[model samples]
Target chain A: MSGASVLYDVPGPKAKVRNRIYSVLGALAVLALIGFIVLRLSANGDFDPARWDIFNYAGVRNSIRDGVLATLQVFAIAAVLSLAVGVLLAVARLSDHRPVRWLATGFIELFRSIPLLITIYAIWVLLLNNRTELGLSDNQPQFWALVIGLTVYNGSVQAEVLRAGILSVPKGQREAAYALGMRKTQVMTTVLIPQAVRAMLPTIISQLVVTLKDTSLGYIITYEELLYSTRLLAGNTTVGGENPYVQVIIVTGAIYIAMCLALSALANWIERRGRRAKTGIGVVEAGDVGNAGALTAAVAAEAAADTTADTAN
Target chain B: MNVLLDYLPEFRAGFLGTLAITAASAVIALVLGVLIAGFRVSPIPPLRAFGTAWVTLLRNTPLTLLFLIAFFVVPKILFQGASPFVLGMLALGLYTSSFVCEAIRSGISTVPVGQAEAARSIGLSFTQTLRLIVLPQATRTVLPPLSSIFIALTKNSAVAGAFSVTELFGYAKLLSDKGYAIAVIFLWVALAYLLITFAISGVFRLLERRMGVAR
Candidate 1:
């Protein structure tokens, strides 16, 4: 049979046999590794039915459910706020004023470079230290700390995504908007940003998926997120006489995977819809922008042609 | 400031520990990523399926969950006497390898099909073509993204602190517990991370400038 690879021709008789031997050896090697892992795990009783029994308990299930809810709550707040921050920063970075652009750039770079775990931890500590002065109520500080940390980090990432999207728009669109006598803000808000957002929606949503996963960092600050609750459940003997560490981890990890995959699937769906809509300026027919003089000359020639066509009509 | 000055030695040790963990895990992740990338592009259906499944599962799951599993389950089931440091490295390495695999696979795709076709027409096997002709070109395209992934790996080493692996953040936690100002301790920790990450980015930028091919 012919191979699917465009790079390679169909294997001849002896080559086919050699390829078959290689494939079998590779498959056997992978299988042997898996078998070794399973055997070792079973020897240590990791697969014992009793070890998994705790997950069947009502209390354990409820705790896990509550953990999932808490995780979602943090994620929801962070996701919305981060998008808002991202837009603000991206706009600021693109500002006409030099100072505004520099400040926004600095903020994004600083947060992006630092470890997210440290950011959340620091915010949690600060909030805890200032709890009385700030008049924060009833463990709200942990929630805010997680949300804020996530907002800062992911917001910076989203800003870059949005900026790239905006930059990718054909320069003619911007010139057209300007020719319509629109202000910079008006052009940005009404024309450029909307199209940019549509173009980059897939990236924005995937970043949200990342934001969802990063919520687990709250566990370090002792926030009762899903990972923290799993740790608690695994360590507590009341759930079961034995530590159901493996079982709890499996269940919690599966929940995370399900959520992230759902987000990604949604992103794909939206991307397909956006492609179908195709609602923007068509691809630039002109060649590369080249130098400023060339671009201005092209625009001038197009403007003259437009005027002549208008007069003839 | 006094607290920082007094704990400078501890902070130094922690910084070194963070670097060590990041370096070790990065090496492991790179090797694993190459193998996984090969699997992903292999002719065998099972290998491709396994590679896809591994990347999807690992990439979607929270790194924290992986760390917890490493700390709690792995030692009990796999390596009975391993240190938290080793477990932390294992978790970080495994989690980051998925991202690295993606970077590598995408890099591989960027290498023109014609190059591979030429190699194959010259009687090179798939492995030989990939190793000799494809990967070297792919590396040029892959370096920028690969560097970012490693930068991410470095920042993620902070998670090890939670598992009691006395990296930078762990040391900050210790100082905070010892009556140092919590805000100051963490600010310093964050600054240290910023320095390291910036250095990594700067080095990568230099490497890219020197080695990158103009498209």
Candidate 2:
């Protein structure tokens, strides 16, 4: 068969044999690696039926369920809170007031440059130090710490994403809104933000996925989140003279992956819808703005474009 | 605060630890990423499937979960287990490698079909075409994103602290437990991280400008 690929030519007889050999070898290598892991774990009694039986317990199932609920709780609170913080920071950074702009920039830069694990740890520590003064219960500190830490770091990131979206809008639209005698705030609310939010919906939702994944960080501060719960259960229970860590970790990891994948699927759907919608401005594939590094590149690119436009004018 | 000043040597060690983790993990991420990108683009269906599975599963799972697996689970399977330092490196490198793989694949796609066709017409094999005609150009596009990934990696190295790796975050954690002023400890810790992050972005930015590819 003739090949249509630009990368490779249609295989001749020898090439066909070689390709088949490569396919078999590659599959074997992959399967062998996986098989080795399973065999090793099996030798270690990790896959023992007794070890797996932990999940069959009602209390164990409830813990897993509670873990899911807690993870979702943190995600829900962080998602809404981060979005709100994001909008505030984005608008403030773009403000005409120099002080506000600088402050916003400083806040975003500080939290972003620091690793979020550190931020969350710091907040958790602070809460512990001030638990009595704040009138908080013992458990409240970790929950608030994780929430606030995620809010600050993710909010800064979302601000940059939102700013990029707003900047992607053509100057003519903003000017048109202004020419209609709308105030700056009115023009922003009516003309810019709605379009920016729509254009950036996918990026925004993807950030929420990051938030969801980051909730596992709550495990660090001993928050009774999903990861924390699963870990606690694993550490507390033992079968066949070994903790069910392998079974527990794998199961919980699957739960986290499923939740994130569902959210990512949602992001893809929104992006597809945005593309097909009658909007002239194509959002294109800004899909991976999920990471700080990617978002930084985007905001920097946006800044670069604005400067070039200014230079051209 | 004198907390940072007093523990200058310890802080320096911690800083070096963070750098060590970042550098080692970065090497892993880059190498694994390139190989996986090759897999994704390869003609072998199994290779492509493996590549897809690697990225999807690794990228979606939390890095914290990865640390748990790296520490508790991988040990049982791999047997004898390495030090936490090595485990932390593996976890961080493996996690970041997924992002790196996606970046490289996207970079490869931007190399344009015409270039590959031209290479094929000139009798270049797929590997040679990718190496000679495609990847050289793709590097320009790939650098900016890779910079950010590295910067992100620098920040992420802090996570190693939680797992007993004693990087900057762990050092800060240690100090906090010692009853130092939290603000003082964090201020120093923050500065150390900012230094690393700025150095990464600056180097990448300079390289990007030298290459003259802002995007």
Q: Name the runs in model 1 displaced over 4 angstroms.
A: A1-4, A238-240, A276-313
Candidate 1, residues A122-166, lDDT tens digits: the string is 788888889999998776888899999999988887787667567
Two-chain DockQ for each candidate model: 0.42, 0.54
lDDT of 2 by residue, B1-215 (tens): 78877898889999999999999999999999988988888777789899999999998888899999999988887746599999999999999898888878878877778888889898987688778887788878788678878888888888788999968988899889999878788889999989997898789889878887443
Interface RMSD of each: 12.7, 7.1
| Residue B106 lDDT in candidate 1 | 66
Tens-digit per-residue lDDT, A6-94, candidate 2: 57777789888998999999999999999999999999888789999988899999999999999899989999999999999999999
Model 2 residue runs over 4 Å out of place are A1-4, A12-14, A290-313, B213-215
Docking band of candidate 1: acceptable
Q: Pick the candidate with the highest DockQ.
A: 2
